[model samples]
Target: MGGVTFTAGGSGEITGATFSSGQTNATVSSATVSFTGAIFHNAVMDSLVVSGNSSLTARNCTFTSNGRRGLYVETIYPQGLVTDCHFRDNQEYPIWIKANCMDMLGAGLQFSGNHYQSIAVSCSAGTDIQRSQSWRGQPVALDLTVGSTSGLTVPAGVTLTVAGPVTALCRRFEVAGTLRVGTGNGYQAWLTGPADTRGSWEGIHVSSGGVLCLTDARLTYATTGVSANGATVTLTGSRIVNSLYDGLSTTSDCTVHLDRSYLRLNGRYGLNLLGRVTGRVQNTELAYNGSHPVYALAANVSCLGSGNLYPSNGRIPVGVSCALEPDLTESATWTAQSVAYDLTVNPYGTVLSIGAGCVLTLSPGTLVRGGGVDVHGCLEALGTAAQPVRFLPLGRQEPGSWEGLYFYPGSTALLRHCQVYYAKVGMAITSAGGYVANSQFRSCSGPGISCAGTANPTFYRCVISDNQGVGVYTRDSAAPNLGNLDSAPTHDDGYNILQNNGQYDFRNESSVSPRAQNNYWGTTDPAVVEARIWDGRDQAGLGRVWYLPLATSPAAAFAAPVTGLIMAGATALQAPGGNVEIRVHLLSPASVSLRVCNVAGRVVCSVPDRLTGGVGERLILWNARSDTGRRLPAGAYLLELTARSPDGPSTRRLVPLVLR
Candidate 1:
């Protein structure tokens, strides 16, 4: 039969009919048209076209193998119902309609095997979606303003493209479920705009109590990928790329957790954070962006983690310029970046952890001008011998160019294998206590270490040298543990080295005497040692520096050479029951011992010592368990490996590990 056209003022009802091989299967420009139990196939044009404010009621209809769209509806005042219909194998989209007419689609609609397996929707003005809905097996293109109590779920293995020029608001869904992008199954659900151009649509805006959880999702081609205002977002195994603006922009009291994700090729920053945002980015990549990888100006946002890569970005360093407000309520870790980082921490309870191999510098007159890290909170600078953390001056290499680290009252610190250089005072401890091991405090204008106000800090195998002032100065009843005078195993063997000071090596201005034995103080002569010490022997009211039983020669250096052994392994175990394989290569026959220790330096698991008969590679597997076979809790740990050769060459390596 030829194509049928229903003109204006015409009413048509066709039931139980089949129309095939027509130029146009059916055209409705009339007042009302109803089709029930109908089959329309192999049309030369669109199988069914409804336009000009026509009301179309399609029920129990089957449209298959059409030349164009199975059903196309374009009406300003959309008044129609489509239910229990099957559309398959169409040349174009299975169904195409205007955004305003989306509500006419009812239950029991099946679509399969179309050229574009999606419902193409076009809208000039944005639409308000107020109901709980799930979009699956097809992509819906529209600009949506999801209502406050409404929920939108793009199920797994689905794609929902946000098109048009307006921003989509996913805001405050308090009653229904939160907006969820994709579930994980190696399926990356796509949330994109027009692929031909960037910034085709203003991206998703999540605001005010809205929650967006995206897993295995890819969002791209927008002005900004996801902007949050007082909302919560968690993205895992996701990618947000090719945006005209930032990949993720957070302003004002938001929490975002991003893990194992990529934020790349954005016009602006990968992550732009401004007010009071708090979250962590772990094992993620923020690379090849137009601006900084992470531009964080908020003091509360902790934009740092382990195993994260920042390669080929517009800016090199991770810029941070915020003061931890009244106090820091959460812990933060600063990892190594491509360039030196500028950091300032002030007034906090939580810990500020500096990762191994980080290079920190204080630029003159920039953030915290002329000042370094002034810590009222706890600080843990944990570095290994192979990759020691260094704190150096930016421009001027002379002493007093920048104020050094100051640990104030009620603060604590743990410094391991660290190097401090070109500061006014290398470290000032006032009424604070901590442990410093295998660290060097050098090239300071003032004393290498100034201890006052009843401070008790332990110095073990540390080097304090080349200072204009004294090596170690104590006042106001302060007592420092330089080394153990007696050969007792109960106390730490503090082989501290002090040398090349303009003033005395050890100055005692306090009334309390401190032990300075078992330490190498530049010379082995007792007379020279006494002359370089200012103690009770020189001052009438000051305490004495006990310098007896001094080391005859210099102790072992702070960092041992990496000679005979090389080891490499994964840094993180991402889930429960996960194991990490460590590869060890030896230069000669050696005895190897491996141990797993917690962040507190307590050995929890120890692998049996093995003897390598020849120079070769060996593999060791750690099952994320304790020595007693109990599963380990998820946290940061250290893998310590020691290899000792028969010819007296030895090497040790410390690798950071995270079990999640």
Candidate 2:
């Protein structure tokens, strides 16, 4: 059967055989031949081809040529598929196909030894041919339509013009090049088909083993921009618009990933996920679709990421569940769940309450706005440093636009690296406990943190600034624990920084003076602290805000510093006209101040005020003049030197000075 020619309709399988040195190795008219592990060596073979409506599929086959065409499909409506086949030493084209016939060339088809073109197809319909391997496009215009091919890849800076409807039957499609409507705007590649619903041309059909990936590509004016059937589709920095049907349709267990892409003005849904298809839409924009921006069969289909635009004209899909908390208008209990979208608490006495032991996790960059979050349960909004959770006002972004979070008596919250702004009170705690670490509260009408009724939330590395009212307000029975004050070594070395508030940073409204210690004030002056605080000094009836042992700088707000002081030469120090030299050794940069007292712990004079020094040792010269600027008689005066650093509290040393 080396030179056998089948003129009748039949189907057979050939394997592990060789046919060579023949005028025409094999010819098929109406027959179907499926061969594997077969070799055809042509000594002078004119045609080892399939013709006359025949079908041939050969895998792992070799076709060695001797100055002749390797394989040809020249008959009407013929179909041939060759995969992993070697065609070497062919003087002319290794594979030739008539325009009417179909040839599905799969991967591993090599034609390295072909003298002429490896593949030649007659351009009858002027349609694009389906390709099996990856294609690199030139900077010139390419008018092609893919048909029944495995996949197509167009590189950057290339312009691919779709001459007609591009159909990929069970194939992958990808384009990094510019693809747009080539008819009206010749710069764009578009699918050519009937504008009506009876459009016949299949528009980019991707099926099993096919993945449609597009990056920075513009695809527009198609019957259907993309259709994914049991396939995977990914579009990054791409745009798909002006489709007759859906912009992107995924069905039959398909998966779609869209990142920083745009889908606009499609006839139907911008993205349709049906039949158990899953999708991840991130940093993408979907707008101006005839239907909803995203339409899914069910809620468990797609997950939303940060930075997506849902147009006002588009409606949320009917059956699909949003990535936000359940839309509730009234006071309702929220359970443990993940919120993947922006959540807004409706007005009219509506409160988003979390049930006890329930953990409501907000995704990074998700906003929880409108009305206060009533925490009857635990709130876990632990975001990273890059992407933090934002609690903002849904309507007006001004101060007091909306009420803030309300922690109930038995509830708690763990807000790490979160931001709450544009609210009446950033967080109001009553008889609750939680940890607020690395959080920011800004532009609030009331206190950033208001604690009452035994609310003792520990704040670590928090920043409360620029509020219209007090930064931290502690009422009756409120004891909000600030930075750790343990003398031993500890990792709890972070503290809250309160500054630039319209009112006092700390407002103690209770009968007892609350110790708001180890916090950085905007200024190091004690007078400024007393003026800014609304404590017992401001009002007689209210409690005092004891801010003694205050932090000098932002760095000192967390950990305390260490310093040492000593007399330069002798223990006795002369005052008045005598110069007293004191050596100060510091581990960090600090502001030094020296005080002289009359052994009664009463500061008689501030000898040296505002003496600055960096790390290491420095000698400070004191003229020993009293606050009254007069010479003192011979007496024992207490000389106290205090140094303040940013890392922690100040170090003070007392030495007796004798004035002669």
Candidate 3:
């Protein structure tokens, strides 16, 4: 069947031993061999006769050049799904949809991030077909190298893998869901808190892979041997000390990146990279590992080493050291060497290049300090289902032990299943996409989850109490403000739950609306409980106007969302349920008239003020009523709350009221 151009048939499986073609019009005789990749050199594939009737399979042969495409021969009926196959070279349009894709001058047919100019549609209805999915903007084509297809629409959740030198910072970071540092010792990662000596403190533990990061943190005495199932771990600008076992460890494969960090006073391996591991060490060093300064198995070691990892002999050569500074006083060179500036590198810096797949884990209970990790490029940390990432501060409930977790902007991930506190700020996000849920924040100078003018950043199912400052503050026009609610309440410094440190008036900005809305006061006081709607009876509203009588007892007296402001339709409309209080004052001597009218234009309550004097302001109060003293129905009603001065016209508002 050189170029026989076969016919279409069934939904059965047709096995083939040998099938090959290098020309066009080569139809798939039966479901025999799907032209997995390319049909042939100049192959003219199928022309879709029926729905699921056309299929050409290529079990074991290969096509190397321009030929018919998978979607070319078959029309887009059976959804053009090609699986468990390979395509080599042969080119076709990227996007080739058949249905409603018209303006496609190869348009909709070739939609992608690359051909976005002609394909990527805008957010407007002119092209906004899918509304539920909020597309950031135009799309770009990164998956173009493999397929010669004309176009492809960028769908949601399409993630791109990044390969790099462990320098680029990302927004998100996750480890197993558990405490680390003080609890799981020897992790090489340290924490800084009170009582630097020892305690029954909990250590860090996770079911699987863990990635540790830091930024402005200080760690102290933790358990021994920090470990990860099989995950990439990172430590930048940090410190680790007083550990008993291996610094960091992993089972499967991983890469350990150390930058501007230090390690001291360890009993076992200073830093251990198991399972074909690679350490990208930059401007960092390891010292005082009682046993092997650095441990590695010759079988699993593929290193592009720097001056770190110590000698292959297992110990730091007793001779080599950082150059010392001298002072010509009493015992000059004996001034004692202090490991200054977080880390003391030798003459220059250290750079380690790794191939790819490696699992470098942490020795349990490793104490780490100094500034935490700072990410800026392509990074992906995927822990196991049972094993979430754990970020534990060293020692007990000591303060200033960690710098908290920092998610550099643009990377899109903050952290999950981790504990951060006792440092400065729990989590600080500058400019990026952040999603931090199921996390904890303990005694820290919060401003918990601080975002400095970023895009929609979310903090969901997070426990943030016992901190010193505000909870979640958003400014600079952000959206999707989710999970600002209190799942559980913790206590600490001033502000209790959450504090809206921004200007939008937490009580108003629609971005954040918690089930149990936590106010910016950060405290869970009666005020927050009371003012769940808003506080105060006389608080000035948008018009800056205050209704007469302001508010009534317990009603206007209760607390509200700390919007730092209050608004109302009628002032005297106190805790208005059934009892309505209205005060009336006569104006121009014509008895001031008042009445609460329902939507049907029926006067539910009527109160006429007596002839009054004085040109100044007058107040009127009303006790919610009906013509027959019967409760009004629960529908729309206008509160004709009115007042009039002897010299002024009566003032009244058609305020809406409900019996809720």
Question: Considering TM-score, which of the candidate structures 1 and 2 is the better prediction for this target?
Answer: 1
Q: Which sections of candidate 1 miss by over 4 Å?
A: 1-127, 137-177, 183-188, 193-198, 276-280, 297-303, 331-341, 344-371, 386-389, 393-401, 484-493, 535-540, 557-660
For model 3, residues 1-660, the per-residue Cα lDDT tens digits are 344445554333434322244344344433333443332333444221122334443333333233334223223222223333333444443222221111111111222221111111111111112111211111222121122221222222221111110121111112343121211222322232223442112222222444444432333344443454555555556665655564554555665666665666655655565554555655556676665554443222223133443323234332112122210101001001111111112233111111111112211121222334333321122222233344434345564455665544333343334455676666655554444444456666544555553444444344555556544434343332332323221210112233333221223222322222222233335444344333123243211101111111211101212221011112223343456433221212333456778788877777676234342123454555587977666666666645454444444434444544
lDDT of 3: 0.36
Q: Best by lDDT, which number?
A: 1
lDDT (CA) per prediction: 0.68, 0.61, 0.36
- Per-residue lDDT, model 3, residue 178, is 19
lDDT of each residue in 159-185, candidate 2, tens digit only: 444332222221233443433322322
Better of 1 and 3 by lDDT: 1
For all predicted structures, in order, the TM-scores are 0.63, 0.43, 0.27
Identify the superior model by lDDT, candidate 2 or candidate 3: 2
